[model samples]
Target chain A: MTQRKYTKEKKVGEGTYAVVYLGKTEKSRQIAIKEIKTGLFKDGLDMSAIREVKYLQELRHENVIELIDVFSNDGNLNLVLEFLPADLEVLIKDQSIIFKPGDIKSWLLMTLRGIHHCHRNFIIHRDLKPNNLLISPDGYLKIADFGLARSLGNANEDLSSNVVTRWYRSPELLFGAKHYDTAVDIWSIGIIFAELMLRTPYLPGQDDINQLDVTFRALGTPTEANWPNVTALPLYNAINVYAPPSRQELRNRFSAATEKALDLLIAMTVLDPSKRCNSTQALMDDFFTESPPPTRPENLPSKNTNKKQKTE
Target chain B: MEKTSSLSISRPYYSPKELSYLHSKTIADSKKVIYNQRKHQVYQYLFQIIKVLKLPLKVLNTSMIYYQKFYLFNIFEEEFEDFSNIEKSMELDPFNVSLASLFLACKNEDCIKKLRDILLVANKIKDNQIEENFIELQRKIILGLEFKLLQILQFNFNNQISFSTDSLVLQFCKKINLNYKYSLFCWLVNFDLMLTPIGLTLPPHCIALAIIIISLNFKPNDLKTRELSSGVNENILDSLNPKDFKCPEKLVNEGILYILDFYIHQYNLSILNNYLPQINEDLNKEQIFKFMNLKSKFNNLRTLNEHSIDGNLLKQDESLSLFDYSISSKGTSRFINKRKRLLEEID
Candidate 1:
């Protein structure tokens, strides 16, 4: 056969910067190239575009998205990224995808390690969602999209979270905290974990207010009583009177979860930044330490449930 | 604009043709004044140490300019730096700034490169060389040379042709010179400052030529006009191959004028630092009066923000840790006084 060329692999999704194309590289390697249309700014691929390119270029870890190369021709900037066959959201939506104890544990561990790489480099992956977390065919997770990620030190000295999607967003960021460190990523991980296990968004809120409302209703409310010293956050005053979450309530909702998993969740979902379980510490948690090495995706611990199958 | 929220596409490394105009009609001619032998020794010693360091040629050119700017701020220093705050200004961000703001003309330009590798290449210089004492002196140098550097960078880039001569220099050598400051300047210009816009963001080659022309110590013929001397001429034109340039006549003249004028202007201008109290002060006053008449708009560079050394002092502490804690603190008052003197309002 003559050497094949890309025949419009489906437009998987559109992003703020580029229209993502699922294509194959010249070496016949399957890759995703994000073709960005620069606006009047003649801003060649944007800062975030270059940032993501640089960030991925430098960080070559098991859990992070590996950048192949960036393509720039004439005025257009194209980012040739690694092609991930499926993302966590796809797996989560696939009713056939079973959440065995080992499977869940492996994902959690992989996610933690991926996040750990970011924190070690003093980077904060501002946006972390299951969709952005692509799952390789072999089932390893790659944390993608670092357009907003930044190193800790800035000349301004303003530090507080400027991140978190409203739904999974931490309260600290909601108040417009100026200095955000790795804690913001940890908060997103907690939401991702909840999304994975619960099969639905743990807190599905529309806008910032809606997200806060969903979080409050699910976990009661956050106050200095629960999230100690939260009142001192850069934009802490923006939040209304805090109401502490009932630990009893989380225990009731996640009854299907294992003790270790719940413990990890609680550690990650700490109200205070100091109390949050960092990626390194979370990696050392009992979930991974006691696991049967997560049943290696090929041997999915063989779930045999027959009753009431979820319609895909 | 097709806004890419996932990516922070802020600004491009190159300047557009429209923005390449020099705001000032006439630049200062510092040719008559003589460079103080004391400061010139620093340049001579700066080269000596640069030779020892063995930096890449491209880096050498960029670094020379950075060394000059650093000297502009710390005019009295003759030695290398120990502390640095260049990074704090966000000038260290390789992803954001131009790879070209790094080098110099061929006689001055020792190297050439695409210059991307330099930004990511860190920790090449050993730590012992970066002492606290060294940083303090460097900080003074950066502070002293701030405006002098700005005039070279901002106003002079009114005309040009090439895209990135600085990066072209960096592509050639790891260390272009042995002078510690020159080596560091090469690294900063070709590698560091060229990588970030926070501290010193320079335009591309065309703009670079423009800036060099405008900052000329002697009266320069405007090259934007058809008949201009600041461009490539045929005598030098015959020696170089025409394969590289499409318009060799234009490029050669522009290129040669850039080199001849830049070093000549830069070297002659270096002498003027000693006579700040004489001809320069009068010219400076005249420039101030002329600039003051322009309506207070976006281009008014002499804002309160520019006047305050507090911000610059704080920014300088990041990479060029050359501030004397006692001096930087007490120096703020003196710095303000000095700043006022340099930026004195015309009565």
Candidate 2:
């Protein structure tokens, strides 16, 4: 049942495993055709492709990118994904685009909602950076690229701690804890939240060791008292100790954020994995309901409008 | 606009009658016996491969399911007919198809192993002299079949509901407070059922619940194991409800009758047969007789209504047709998991 349902108009991007093409369906609906390069290596199909297909096929949420369809052509696997032209990272990087307090709140709410859906299904989006949180044409934020995502299986199963980008990596993952949970994704979202406020990466460590120092120096070193058995982690070692940030220091750090926002951020970025607030708790936090309501999706600042105005 | 004839929506499941109809079309009468014989041998071969790889039981369970599921849509020995070269055909042998299934299963279950490493272990198990050229050809064939296996699955990676049947069986046993011996008995039944088409017919949860009910009723007092002291909990069986496990009564009944049928017919070849004694002392008969008795008792149970499924519907099911691998290469074959979405698209 192979028909020309979609037409690949142009190549948009290329990764190690797939070449993404900007395409359109027969109904003129925009789609991204991810043509996976099969049989390239001795492994045949890539693990990331399998993970993407396995998890994305099961998940269906407004805040998550839709896997429109999956088909193959000329021995190459093509994943038809909903085309998302913009992402949170691009918006955060554009210095001219001033982010309103409501805009930041809206993006955070959408991100949390998407993640809550995944966590409810027992899936952990291991790579939940701003880059993967794509924006649709109508300004909806979607969680995309589930290359490192996996479902929470048996309790005794060991997970690889060497996941999530170094800057957004959680404390448990940084210290090499294999028995972590969805708390790791919460930590990444917390960092992304901080980046939205600062308009830059919250933690810009050069390497793994620097990442640990940068993370602890910003939030305070995790000790046996705060995070029990943290010292027992595989990568835990002697490091420079630092005091936890006081309320005044945090307030000064994120001057524009409300008290509730700071409280939610602190809850999400807890040093201990068990103590970290999950997606549901984070969504239920008073920050979302307090003060100015989040900006409507259509009214949210977009890069496309700015580009068009500059061209005119 | 061009007609989207190549968009094949994924229908991951079918009724028992539908499955039989598919098999009748795919497997010729002359090749049916040979197909079953090879399937059994391949099951053992995959078990060994999984054992050597140190993969979990879910991986083996999923691989066997994929191996069986592949033959339902594709011809049993069509690969040999396509490949002209004898060496190339050898690469696409039944063992290689099983390897490809195991390979995809490992990835799907998230217990991944390198294809080369798996091939190495498989070669060692088969005692094939792994020449460099032969290994390359085998790798190519396995890789090719891996893609075909994905299409056979219709890109529906989530085959089982939440977990595979073996783990679900153990989980259900623990939930029902069954003793270790009884739980082991259920697990062994699951192991035996993995080799049958019960997985294709019923969901994992239903099959798991059915196994628990069977174990409780079977009362395997003479089950061979190190921890045989813990006797069966007869009260738990009375308290057991299918709703507690999220399994419909009809589906669980179907699973029960199907499992009883499998054991009645193929008890001697089953793994459970090895552990139990030749004669059941309580009933003063063989284990097959116990299964037969269970079958007689459960004969009145309600199962899935296949009567509503007309013969023409089964005959016209495009999903059950022999999957044309070249269709995707020619155009687009869209895979959607939900039947509702397919209907919406049709409208």
Off by over 4 Å in 2: A1-4, A305-312, B1-5, B78-84, B228-233, B309-312
lDDT by residue (B1-347, candidate 2, tens digit) is 64323556665567889888888987888889888888898888988988888888888778888888888887776366655686667654778888998999888888888888898999999899999887887887888888888888877888653588888898888887888878888999999887777777788999999999998889888888887466655688789989988889999999999889999989999999988999997898998999999899889999888887887987787777888776676655666667777777667
- Write down the DockQ of candidate 1: 0.01
* TM-score for predicted model 1 compared with the true structure: 0.48
Q: Which candidate tops DockQ?
A: 2
Docking class of 2: medium
DockQ result, candidate 2: 0.58
Candidate 2, residues A203-294: lDDT per residue as tens digits?
88899999999999999999999999989999999777999999999999999989999999999999999999988899999999987899
Candidate 1 local Cα displacement, residue B97, angstroms: 11
Best by TM-score: 2
TM-score: model 2 vs. ground truth:
0.94
TM-score of each: 0.48, 0.94
lDDT per residue for candidate 1 within B251-327, as digits (tens), equals 32333333333333343343222222322233354332322222222132221122343444534432232222232
